[model samples]
Target: MATAQAAAGRTFTTDIPARLDRLPWSRWHWSIVIGLGTVWILDGLEVTVVGNIASRLSEPGSGLPISSGQVTGTAAALYVAGACVGALFWGRLTDRHGRKKLFMITLAVYLAATALTAVSFSAWWFFLFRFLTGFGIGGEYAAINSAIDELIPSSYRGRVDLVINGSFWIGAVGGSLLSIVALNTDLLPENVGWRLTFALGVVLGLVILLVRRSVPESPRWLLIRGRDREAEEIVASIEQKIEAEKGEPLPEPAGELVIRQRESTSFAEIAHTVFSAYRRRAVLGFSLFVGQAFLYNAITFGFGTILIKFYDIPAGDTGYYFAVIAAGNFVGPLLLGKLFDTVGRRVMISSTYLLSGVLLFGTAWLFSRGSLSAVTLTACWCVVLFFASAGASSAYLTVSEIFPMETRAMSIAFFYALGTAVGGISGPLVFADLTGSGVVGDTVLAFQIGAGLMCAAGLVAAFLAVKAERRSLEDIATPLSVEKAPTAEAVTE
Candidate 1:
């Protein structure tokens, strides 16, 4: 059965089709995962940079002129805005141009914009640059998710993606650590630290670009787009890697072939495509996207402010808080990745949001009573942050796996755009309001509210996730057999 399954999936390994099961860890596959992973990590880092630098950015004489509140708030707003623009514009582009090309395009935008961020003279320049940086970010969600969904092998898909998705925290932690060093030192003005932080973004992007150059374009995409020759080349590359590893010539590509002449695709068609082939999956995906974006935004944007307000901690503590938070984010997904497959997405993800809510609420209460010692505060907060971040990956994992390929980018974009818009708008405003003297006086009631919403979102996801996980991650994203449809086509494929 295993061999049959392997043989049934076709690759471009030869002029004739070869089974794909025999080619696990093909060089091209690894390259795709690595390239996408690098971009994701950087996106997470760049998005969270404002949170790390909020105190300093908002402080007068910090070498940048702005209210810390304004800086943090505006950055949050811009990040979402940029992401919206990217998700909207790039969704179609990713579909039309193919994932690999779109990935490079976004990376270029990200690389250049992030580098220039170091040199902004005023808030306007900084704001505008941050928005442009968001364009890279916007494109990233579409490109990376699309590439990984198509390229990663079936068996290893869940665990590998879970872990790779977790790496986003690495950049966030890196940003926090670097921010700590720059902000704490009298060696450079506050502005210089932020500059360096963004400079490091340039270097990281270059590393990803270097890694990407060795990667092959998606054969699945090439075949679908009617670039059969390029698909064949990509397949040859995969076969070569398998042969080298196995110390034998690799089998050729095989399976039921349904080669169709490619047709031009348009932005408007994305909506039609998404709804037509995989409406249920599309709805679920959009829900997850919106919920995850809202919670993730709150955490990423509001963390620094919360720390500064609640802890009375100085600017350098941004490092400690962010590091701990990023660590939690990274570690939780890793520990939970296998369990996601085992315990099921419904349980793993739903619990993450629910637990995150409980802990966040608890954290708020502790803050209000002045009961949490510094150690306790950090430790408890890390626990909350961990679940939040991990839950985020779980949400993506579920959504990505469930949705069909026909309009994956479009659906993801909708979720991302709406969630960010809502979360981005609400996170700072709500946090500001909750932190006011009138509302539980330093109690994180606002945090509790956000946490509760996360819990609620989790519940909705959990209920829906059974359908998502009805088939394994490796399963083609086909509509349920009994689902109302006149005809069916591949959604997950």
Candidate 2:
């Protein structure tokens, strides 16, 4: 490998992007997926355990003196609040400091916060740690999504991203099953069971952190920051390992990107580039994220309350129902993910959002008429979320891929924070109160609101989603670090 020449305002051309995207799928790529992607599973477990345990936590013998409404509503909102703030805070750092460093730091933050949460002696203590835990997970979203998109080959980016994001439901499924064991008073005491869940999350996060240490920083990110020689070395190392695996020399890289390297991008520049330069995309991102956040928060946070209040199901039994829907959520992305790459982002995103919305409306109607049992209702949710999960997972993929490389982490953080703040914080509060009222009409109305927003987002995606599938990051949006002068391969639009 040749050394990258540099000047005061460093500018250079390198084939790092092409070198990464052109490599064949190998064990190394799987390592990246397992290392970075498993965090979502942990996230899913954290959320699902909280939801399933809301009833248990509200009981008299439970460790904390909190109501089911407070557990599901206030605590849930605080977690989201933490995530919103954390996404923006750590997201900025990820863009400035580099993906590898921020991801590792964020995971450590999560582990420590979760450990504290497991030892909470009061409601406030639990609430504070919930917020802190979300803070770490929120940073993981911006950092991991940016890294995954940068590292994965363009041909596989869409499906891989969808599966990774959807992996949150895998944790949800585990949480559901785990809650059954933990919440069984016959098996474990009430106070002890709830605390055990958080401890388990810390354990899983530790394993992910160990694997994540080996994952390299994004070469694209390194080159843009004037660390060209390090970037080349990383890519060269991967190529050698891959060729040895394939027993053949790799094909020549296709193109090069010339970057005027900078250590940091100002928030002002990132904001202008996203909202001003790509105004339509900005709207699309907000709509998609808000829609999914509201829909997921409404259902995930309130599933236990709804089952107990409306269906007379035992608190311990809710997990079985939730586990079914969680499976549906994961299956949606695994099944429909390929279409986003092959059939295109516009069709898959719009169709999944619209289809899921329609199904949810049907569920609301059936429930209003008292025409569904607990089993049937869970089935309905399973079907609706099958499509919704794919659409929601696609939302992350859209924001991460459609922005300039220089602003990737910040753009993801900005939209995720904005959308999640609006939808996530408010969704649980609203749903908790509505479902707690025990009025079928109130619950039905809540369902209608979530369904409406999802449909609206789908319509926005139909018109605004970019044709970003199977394209290099630079092709979708020009990097801010690129030279002002025209390059033969520079993507204008």
Candidate 3:
């Protein structure tokens, strides 16, 4: 463990990024994955539990005076809005302060908010805590994605990131099952079960926080902050650990990064790098995020309501159907994630988005015609989300990789906040209103909107997605600190 001292404003050349990238995958890597990736499960649980319990919350004896519409529409929108605000607020700090610090702080925010949410005695109280919880999760997105991508080897990065992001659905599946039990009066009282769900999220988060303490800071981040000695030590320690575990010496890292080390990147510089120098990538990131955000929010936030209103399914029983689709979502990324690395990002990303969009359009048409039952509709959702889930996960991968290292977290925050603001915030609100009308036509309209955006984004990805698989981060986009200096200090530790 080293601090950023005695290294600021220095110029140095080191192979920190390359060394980290060349090491073989080991148990050490799995530790990082477990420590950092489990937060998504908490998010998945939060979202799924809310969606599943929408009807129960709207009932007369649910402790809170919230309507189903308020739960799905107003509360959901506030949560997403908070996330957008939180991403912007915390993202800059993450880039300045380091990923480890921001992620730890953000998780604490989420835990505290969720714990308070469980004790809510009024609708406003519940809504306020939901937003606070989202604020924390939003910051987690920026910090974790940047750290995971920077730490993982280029060869394994695509699949690992996708699987980790997709693991959110595992929590969804868990929440869905938990909701069934929570909503069942025989198992637990309505007021008690729902509160317990939020409390459980806090417990899970505490476990993750304990594991996260051992997860190291990003060597790449340290290197750019002029902590070359610290960065070099971390990389060497990782190499030695991996070598000992694998019983072989790691291959020599092939390239050096010559950087003018600075303590932090300014907001103005980050904005220009993302929006000006990499303007095309900015467009691509926006398109991908909007497509996924709208599609997911519209469907997931309102799905239980769909089952209840259209099919007369009980609120407690809805979790069973949701679990099926949640499994499909997780499986899509787990199975297809490798193809992102092997077949190339453009083909896989575009194909998944386009295929899911086309499938959803068909599902919508069938639903409008009243040709499907609840069981058949859930099956259709499983098929559609199988691809959509993978496409959505890639949106994160695309944004995190295409930008320069200096702007990585902020770029993720900017596009995520922007796209989620446009799509995530509005999507749930629109879908809740549309579906709440109990008019088949209104629901169909919502479906078509999500489908069209996904299709449009796929077309954009066809032309704009980066082929970033198996490439070093520096090669993908040169760091802003990179420069040639005749008298540059070289630290080849």
Candidate 4:
């Protein structure tokens, strides 16, 4: 590896980005996926457990004295608020410091907060802990998404990210099954079982923390920070590992990015980049995020309530139905993720969003007419979310890809914060109230609103989506600080 120190405020060139993009998929990449992608699973588990146990928490002998609506609405809203704040706070640090530092710290915060949640005895205590847990998971989103994009080969980025994001349903499935046991009087006492459910998340987070220790910082991020020597060495190490695993020499890396080395990017610069220069992309990201956030948050947080309140399904049986729904969510991304990289981003994103919206409208009509049983309604939900999950996962992929390298983490944070604030915070509260009404018409109205927002977002995507399939992140959006742009010939290579 070679070394170079930039003169103050001067520019330098490096092939680190190209070197990273050219490597073959190997265990090196799988380790990164396991270490970072598991956060989604943890988040899914947290959300599903709470939703499935809402009735348990609201019972008279349960430790908390809150109503089911309070448990799902107020607590869910506070968790989202914490996630919004955490995204901004940790997002800036992720871009400024480094991907490795913030991801590790954020995961540690999540583990601690979730552990505390298991011991909560009152509504306020539970709310505070849930907020803290959301705070940690929120930070993980900014840091992890940025790192994964920077490290993975562009050809694999779309499917890799979508599948990882969709893994939340893996946790959702686990949570649903776990709740069935936890809520079972024969297996565990009510209060004890609910507390144990939260503790399970802490255990999972701890295991991931150990795996993350082996993952390295983003070499592209290191180069931009003026640590050219470290960046070169890390890339070299990764290439060597990949070659060894493949038992053959790797192809030579092509292309070059010349950038002005900067110690840090200011929040003002990140904001200006999003709002002024890349304004249309900002709009696209916000629309995609807000739509999916509202729909997912509403359904995931309050689905159990709808089952119990509207269809007279017992609380214990909700988990069985939820497990089926979660399987559909997981299968959508697993099956459709490859198409995002092959079929292109614009068409797939729009089609999934529009189709899901159309399906939700059909679901609303059936429910309003009282024409569906609990099993039939659950089946309807599975089909609707199958398309919606893929669309929702693509939203994260869109924000992460359509921004400059320097602001990637913050871009994710900005849109995630704004979208969550608008949709995530309100979705649960609105659904909780509507579901509590126990009137099919009321819940039907809520479904229509969600369907409308999703359809509107799809239209926005069809107009503004970036055609970024199988392209390097640099090609999608040039780094803000690139000193000498790549020539036409180099770009084509």
Question: Which residue pairs of candidate 2 clash?
Answer: none
Compose the digit string of candidate 1's lDDT tens values, residues 411-439.
56666777667776676555654552344
What overall lDDT, based on C-alpha atoms, would model 1 receive against the true structure? 0.67
Worst 10 residues of 4 by lDDT: 484-493
lDDT of candidate 4 at residue 190, scale 0 to 100 = 77
Q: Roughly what TM-score does model 3 have, to 2 decimal places?
A: 0.97
Stretches of candidate 1 exceeding 4 Å from the true structure: 1-22, 26-29, 248-257, 266-269, 436-443, 466-475, 478-493
How many clashes (backbone atoms < 3 Å, residues ≥3 apart in a chain or on different chains) does model 1 have? Answer: 10
Per-residue alpha-carbon lDDT of candidate 3 for residues 1-493, written as tens digits (9 for 90 to 100): 3355556677778877878888888999999999999999999999999888888888888899998888888999999999999998898998999999999999999999999999989999999999999999999999999999999999999999999999999999999999998898898887888999999999999999999998888989988887778777888888888988999888887778678877777878888878788888888999999999999977678888888889999878999999999999999999999999999999999999999999999999999999989999999999999999999999999999888888899999999999999999989877888876789999899889999999999999999888788988777777788874222232111
Q: Decide which is better by lDDT, 1 or 4.
A: 4
| lDDT at residue 480 of model 3 (Cα atoms) | 82
Tens digits of per-residue lDDT for model 4 on 365-457? 999888998899989999999999999999999999888889999999989999999999988887888867888788888899889989999
**Candidate 3 segments whose C-alpha is farther than 4 A from its true place:** 1-6, 484-493
Regions more than 4 Å wrong, model 4:
1-8, 487-493
TM-score of each: 0.86, 0.97, 0.97, 0.97
Per-residue CA lDDT of model 2 for 1-493, tens digit only, reads 3223343257777778878888889999999999999999999998999989988888988878888888899999999999999999999999988999999999999899999999888899989999999999999999999999999999999999999999999999999999999899998999899899989998889988998999999999888776888888899999999999999999887877777887678888988889888899999999999999989987568878889989899899999999999999999999999999999999999999999999999999999999999999999999999999999999999999998998899889999999998899988888888877899999999889889999999999999989888888887888888774233345433
Name the better of 2 and 4 by lDDT. 2
